[model samples]
Target: MATCQPAPTCAPVATCQPAPTSQAVCPQPCPIPAQFGCGPLPKITNLVCATDFDKAYIPAMYQHNMDIIAVASVGAEMAPSDDITDLAIKIRNERIQQNQKLALFARQAGYGALPVDYNEVAMYRNQLMGVAGMDFSARWATLMVGLLQQSQQSAQLAATRATLPQLRDQGNINARACANEIDALQRWLARNGLPVSATAVPGVCPPGAIAAPYGTGPSAPICQPTCQPTCQPAAQPTCPPGSQPAYPPAPVY
Candidate 1:
């Protein structure tokens, strides 16, 4: 058999390709005015006045006027705790004295001097119990005002409860935005022949892909090496002093 001619040596093929340029993709900007929808408008307070006028006009007017006065007085009485406590104490004492005076007046008028029978005594006792309960309520109302003034805990409690839903919504929105960006980056890295694993983690760039160096450091140098015409030996990843290598060498084909 004839000896085989020596195979001709060919130039080594270039394995390193230039990293693909990343397309400048930006997220669609959020809309202004937020496209927020409002719920139905409330019926105006004047509507109540109009309806009241259509009914027995004089009585309706009187009732509405009294309602306004009562609301105004209650609002004034329930002003900040510092101002309300003294007023509440004075009101409670006056109310108790007035009830006692009314009871005495009724006894003198022969309206409450009934005989001491089980039914009569029971009725009187119930009336006295009701008056006592009202007095206790007034005293408790004053005590509550004092308690509110002594601590700002209630205000803090209300603020904490109000912010909870807003905080939860913000967290959810951030997480979703992060996931979308990461997915896009993974696809980009894979298309450019860079090793990357898909992940759900937000804001994290794909691992193992080379990024342009930010400064003159070795890890991110000012000038990058260009691919040679022929495939050269793969460079070993440089490790910092006292640092371990992150991965094993890629297998040579």
Candidate 2:
């Protein structure tokens, strides 16, 4: 009757929720052509292609540096040191071995591999090498002509010097062409669903068909150099116990 008895004391009740499923998301394996051996062709995604293409610079620069050395050795007051040449040779051989591995991996990928771009990268590199060789020979000839007749020396040297820019321009063109090819290859890979780029479009979109936000810049160029991986030495494999080690030495060129 007096004031309400002490309010009934209540115990706290705990609530339990179901545990989350411990499922893992795995990418569907690539469809390996019958020729490639097992289950699925190794997934050669856009990223992988970019990586291999970037690795190409290894051989490209190797060839460039070797040509430079050869040219320098042609007519120098003192012969270029063997130490540097030997080092370059060693470095190039190692790079060549790596590129060979990459080529094998792609070939093994069989039909899953990205379409070949006419070996454009290699072609440009060869062109650059050829240009360098030609330049050296021309200069050597001019030098000989100069020594034979002092009067013709100045004119011959001048003529050769005038062509020097053209030679350099040709090399630049070749380098840029190679770089462009690398970009194209990445786009091809992305389109084929190798990496499945979010923004990559297989075919060209009609002009202004896809509108961009008010502030954003125009749609990205069909193919940009950004698509390609940086020009740096690729990560090398770890050496097994007691095996000779390989290091990514500095760029010779």
Candidate 3:
């Protein structure tokens, strides 16, 4: 008991530890963030389609269409045919009559009524001497020659006028056929739900291709309707009291 009491009375000694060395703080490498999404984007769909477009034959069909377009464009240039030869003849006949009248007046005025051309006068004088003898009036003879010449010229014009109608009709037929073919193609494309816009596909034709520089309208001029004059009945006259009114006929009468 005496030994334990003596040991408890002694004081305990304290030990000192060294300070921590402050090395530069090292940084650790960071990992990339994980991505969360609905997977890869879906492929876009092609809306335009041709029922007959088998990859094998599509190019040929396209080329054929282009050829048709080319011919159709050229065909549209054909003009409609018309025959105005009767009108032309009437015009010439009128001109000849006027000249004859002028010649007749010249003769009556005591002026030298010889033919305008020296050669024509000589030819007329010869013909007159051979046909009607020297007794025929020179002025009348020359006028007859002029009339004959005019008749001949008119006949030649009529002959020439008849020749071009066949060619013109052919051209018009070709043009119409081409137009129909083109229209059918357009309708088919529309029915098949094919793209009609030029920009819809690379190298495609524009929407105007169906009607412009390519497909033109009919070249024939429209025939205007004749303005028929109507005869209106005259209005009845009105009397003022005991006096009768003097009335002019209706304006259309």
- In order, the Cα lDDT scores of the candidates are 0.29, 0.30, 0.27
Model 2 agreement with the true structure over 161-251: per-residue lDDT tens digits: 3223432333343344333433443444445444312221112112222211221111122211122223444344444455444444434
> Which candidate number would show the highest TM-score if scored against the true structure?
2
Per-residue alpha-carbon lDDT of candidate 1 for residues 171-240, written as tens digits (9 for 90 to 100): 2432343344334434444554644342111111112222233321111111112222334455555445
Best-first order by TM-score: 2, 3, 1
Please identify model 2 stretches exceeding 4 Å from their true place: 1-79, 111-253
Which portions of model 3 miss their true places by more than 4 Å?
1-163, 197-253
Per-model TM-score versus the true fold:
0.16, 0.21, 0.16
**What TM-score does structure 2 among the candidates reach?**
0.21
Clashing residue pairs in candidate 1 are none
TM-score (C-alpha, index-matched) for candidate 3: 0.16
Give per-residue CA lDDT, model 3, range 1-253, as digits (tens). 4454332333332322334443443332221112101011000000011122122112222222222222222222221111112222333344344344434444554444433333322432343333232222222222222222222222222233223343233224333433443344344335546532211000222121111122111111111112233445544444445443334433431
Worst lDDT window (10 residues) for model 2?
35-44
Q: On a 0 to 100 scale, what is the lDDT of residue 102 in model 3?
A: 36
Q: Candidate 2 vs candidate 3: which has greater TM-score?
A: 2
On the 0 to 100 scale, the lDDT of residue 245 in model 1 is 37
lDDT, model 2:
0.30
